[model samples]
Target: MFWIDDLWKFGISAFVGTLTVFVPLLDTRTEALDPIPVVVTIPILKDLAEQVGGPYVRVTSLLSGYENEHTYSPKPSDLIAVRKARLLFEIGLGLEVWISSLVRNAGSQALRVVTTSQGVELIQDDADTHEHPHTGKHTTDPEGNPHIWLDPANALIMLRHITDALIEVDPSHEAKFKANEAAYRERLRQLQKELSDRTQRLPDRRFIAHHSAWPYLAKRFDFHIVGTIHLQAGTEPSALHLQSLIEKIRKEHIRVIASEIQLSQRLPELLSRETTARVVVLTTMPGGVPGTETYLDMLRYNVLQLVGALETT
Candidate 1:
């Protein structure tokens, strides 16, 4: 009877030892599979983060490209996302004016806010004149235009910042992050060259912009921005301004009017009706339109669509 009891005790001891040895290993594996939680202010940042972070990050974008970034009101879910995120990326230069309050409300102790626009060259806008007429909403940044992502070259700067932040948070995946960035960089350069070459053959590269979102893109692709329909977002150009633009468009033969999908098409359509210029609907953000889901796709779609319109009209 005593020998049988001793054998039972030994069996229990062996099982306990096996559990102690295997439990942590299983836990470690599960922990490794859990991705880093990231929050971004705009879809473009989300795309850049995902491109660099790859499987290492789970990103949530506050603005889904459909919303006007300047006028966006943060949702409850946005607060929750910020609270859960280790890294929060923004274009910074005052583009996301609501982000500070959102992050403050989140009360995340461990959250690090990364401004990708830190080292990039900024384009200044007429902040005084660009205020929304109705709501008095300030559209342009006093610091600079926060649309740096419109240029592929600036996008590369943003990508580098994203990679650095990702590496800082998840140092174990540094090689993967760098590699992904390099690959995407090459792709961006190739696309940039392709677009440049295409634009080179165009006789008329001038257009009337829907808003002040095209300066960076225009600089990159050599397209001339003849006039802007809405100097300030959510504010309509006056009849006098519209008349002036119509006259300019007809005189300059600015065949293309670059309007964004995020904006109301009424003004652009009006311009088209008044003049021979064709409105080529473009997107400033990824996922703003079908087939422009990624940064590269949006860049290609914008340039090619504008080019097609310019050439045909």
Candidate 2:
């Protein structure tokens, strides 16, 4: 006959053994609940992916907001991230010249590279006419400008691509992605309207861009990009071009020169000193500037800051 203590011991041992067997199973289930992994070429894409994917995605942006997208080189971690990701999002249009090689090297058979700029109408980089001092090569995209995300309308298009991609990879979360996308679109529209209303009040809307990144934004917001300081990436403008820009600003009374945080400020400042036009440093990427983390926030910040500068002049 078994004593009561023996039975108790037997029960405890059985419970322990069962737990030991099931713990890994439980851990696997928990791990399965984790979000899908994704990688994006830039911070703006990361924001869009997160907005649409919500809790369903774990996104890593290869280029932080502070880096120049044209000149970015993928780090080893970027390759690792690409290898692990189910999807990789980029603006395309030759924006990330280095991304293709990285993807090839990553050898991620499951990874889908989604070009978010697929359907949107592209703006030609007219700055190509100005010769770059170093390479003398045109930095402009032969197809179209890669800085399409600078405009809110283009952002909506990009967001749709992100939503579609997320749904494609994780169909289980389709409803969530669609719903989040709709909510984000509504908010984006509201911000666009608000900014439009504010911009309409401006008497003069001409500015000099640091680079060719602003054509889409300028077109969307009805602002005029009177001139560009650097026509090519990683190249300096000629003295003649600088003198021309100074003459243009002085002659046209171009009140604002919009400089990017990612680019050097010396030229803009020098131009400012040469003329009455004030330099308002803005960012092409989200989180490149404080109070500009979200896409909407960055849009508002850029528009409002430029409006403020234009108004003051």
Candidate 3:
């Protein structure tokens, strides 16, 4: 098994290694690149890269909104992005399985891959280990909950990582990164106040999410995750699974089933009917849906949705 794994790894390495370059450039311009090419896994980093990179940096997001970050298929163009990127930012904690191979193929240790989920508290997926539908188990944040972005307080930690990486790669932009971090941190603080106030109004602070994506939110707002609609990131729920969740809902009187905007809503909506719980769409990724474009707005939108759903229930 070990040799087999090694051989498979070698095959992937060789393929990606040779094809790293010659793919699409994120944004094309004739001038010599000034800031740096930074490849990020999801939208939050893209948003941050925009703020911190400003005019100096050029950013490319590997996964689009329709593309699930967890189970991403790297086009040759993606390898090209990795090949050219001076720095790669990811939510890490095994959130991106393709990173290791892609980096290996790019053959640039100097690329400086930064995992934003670093140093934040991680919750083990102890509820169950099955994979969900629409993607693989690899698509799920395997190291732990990579949804640290959901917590505004935790995003501050990501800013530190971003600043350090930017300063390391482009020391000339140290002040710019610092300034960006300071400004973003201030906005985060205001968002914290807003989230606290909004969450405080939920008469029933307890609700169940489709998965175990709510611990940070629950911790922040004193809400409770009564049960999960799915056991894993893409695994389908069986009859037994549905029956078990129904029992928990009945016991807890779970008012809302917080289905993430990124995931398919069929199961959550169906579970909502089963439990008589309202289906609430929450954004895990920045811009995962229509209303959650900015970090603060995402939190506000989720809190408002949760508060409104639970309060009315």
The top-ranked prediction according to TM-score is 2
| Per-candidate clashes, comma-separated | 0, 0, 7
Q: Least accurate stretch of 10 residues (summed lDDT) in model 2?
A: 132-141
Would you give me the overall lDDT of model 2?
Answer: 0.89
Q: What is the lDDT of residue 293 in candidate 2?
A: 92
Please identify which of the two predictions, 1 or 2, would achieve the higher lDDT against the true structure.
2
Candidate 1 TM-score, C-alpha based: 0.87
Score residue 124 of candidate 3 by CA lDDT. Answer: 60
- Candidate 3 residue-wise lDDT, 80-187, digit = tens: 998888888898765677778988998876588888877898766543444422234443544666567777778788878887888888787789888988988898
TM-score for candidate 3: 0.82
Please list all clashing residue pairs in model 3, or write none if there are none.
Answer: 35-56, 70-139, 131-235, 132-234, 132-235, 133-234, 133-235
lDDT of 2 by residue, 1-313 (tens): 5655765877877767877999999999987798989999999999999999988899999988999888888899999999999999998877788999999999988999999999999877665475332234464425777799989999999999999998888899899999999999999999999999999988898999998889898998899998989887777789999999999999988889999999989999999999999999999999999999988899999999999998998
Q: Highest lDDT: give the candidate number.
A: 2
Candidate 1 residues lying further than 4 Å off, grouped into runs, are 1-29, 126-142
Provide the TM-score for each candidate, comma-separated.
0.87, 0.89, 0.82
Q: Which stretches of candidate 2 lie over 4 Å from their true place?
A: 1-28, 127-142
Please state the error at residue 304 of candidate 2 in Å: 0.5
What order do candidates take by TM-score, descending? Answer: 2, 1, 3
User: Which candidate order results from sorting by lDDT in descending order?
Assistant: 2, 1, 3
